[model samples]
Target: MDGPPATPPAPKAPTLGNALHRFANPGRFMRLSGALLPWLAAAGLALSVTGLAWGLVFAPRDWQQGDTVRIMFIHVPAAWMAMGGYVGLAVASFIGLVWRHPLADIAAREIAPVGAVFTAICLITGSLWGKPMWGTWWVWDARLTSVLVLFFLYVGHIALSNAFDDPERAARPAAILALIGAVNLPIIKFSVDWWNTLHQPASVTRLGAPGIHVDILQPLLVTGLGFLFVFAALALLRTRTGILERRARALMAARAAEPAATPSAVAV
Candidate 1:
């Protein structure tokens, strides 16, 4: 007989990949999102109202831009979300392409339209602010041009994602497009520094001290948080809708494929 039994190996630690894999189950995600939806909606609405009111009414006016600077409350958050949304989309696309996660594919598809809307909002608000400050409705600046390309990429992704009758066939091409489009993101972020541009350089995110004053920065941060919450809530809603729609379609297809009963069987 052996003197002692062999020791067992230690269990492996959980990782990000394993955590993400847990959400691959549509039922689990639906349950989780349903539970969180109300809280997300309430927080998003409350924070947005508070932030907008604080920034628009209570914050001190900018010395240079005056009241027009208040546009920052909306424009800055929209721009941030536009960029952030694409990042989320690209990550989802990568997951879907590599792991073939159905939820990831749904996430990638659902995020495109939301990201496009945010990009549009950013452009419109920037134009509105520019008319007053820059004395023009639009400019072909590097930052602006890159962002415009981003918007177009979003539109293309949405179209490509839905082009095929079979969604499984659709997912791969859209994921590839999303990955290719991700190149524009870094260009959009660094456009101001890499080349001359009409757009202002970084204010809050710079390496040295922030260029903006505390009074303005506080509301900006708050508003940004509110926008982020809103995006999260909307994304969750869309993803859940997608999952339900897919399930419904699958059920319908299953019913359609069943063989019809013979006349004798029906009569009996």
Candidate 2:
């Protein structure tokens, strides 16, 4: 018989990192995400509608740009989401490269298209706004050019991600490209201050108070947040769909590979 009772070790404390890793299990992720999907969708839609309506209908027009400033609501949000989305891509790529996580790789692949769309929207609206303000539809300014490069990076990642039949092989190169392309993000952010450009300098983000008027900035912030929420919801939905499709393919292939059931020797 033991003379002294031994003390039991304390259970490990829960951590944010550890909790997040639980989603690495595809079955666990599917169930949780399915339960949460409707809430995300509803919240994104509601915020987007409210923000867009407020920005378009209720916000005051700028004296300098007049009604043309309305484009900022749309253009600014898209621009922010484009960069924010790229940052997310780079993060996902980093995770994929280091951990070889299937979810991270799938997330990186799915994020590319959404980021590209936002980049395209940014360029289009910027051009539309520029035509009236700058008297041109296009300009090779530092900010604009950097954003263009960002767009190209997104496209290249998408192409590379799909180039290989083996997703694992494809993931490495795509992840590398995403990491490399992350260099362009800072350039896009600082291009206005770094060099002369038709594009305006920071209005909503600055050293002290935002340069933008509050009447305009409030709706802009709301719309930007809405855009961010929608982008997140969309990316998660795509990732979920990708996971389901992959599982379906694996099931089909496994069934095909099964030995044909021996036709019952038909005893006449």
Give the top-scoring candidate (TM-score).
1
Q: Write the per-residue lDDT of candidate 1 for residues 55-82, one digit (tens) a residue.
A: 8999999999999888999899989999
lDDT, candidate 2, 54-126, per-residue tens:
8889999999999899999999999999999999999999988887778888889999999999999999999
Off by over 4 Å in 2: 1-20, 264-268
lDDT of 1: 0.92
Q: State every prediction's TM-score relative to the real structure.
A: 0.93, 0.90
The deviation in Å at residue 193 for candidate 1 is 0.1
Report how far residue 15 has shifted in candidate 1, in Å.
6.7
Candidate 1's C-alpha runs over 4 A off are 1-18
Assess candidate 2 and give its TM-score to the true structure: 0.90
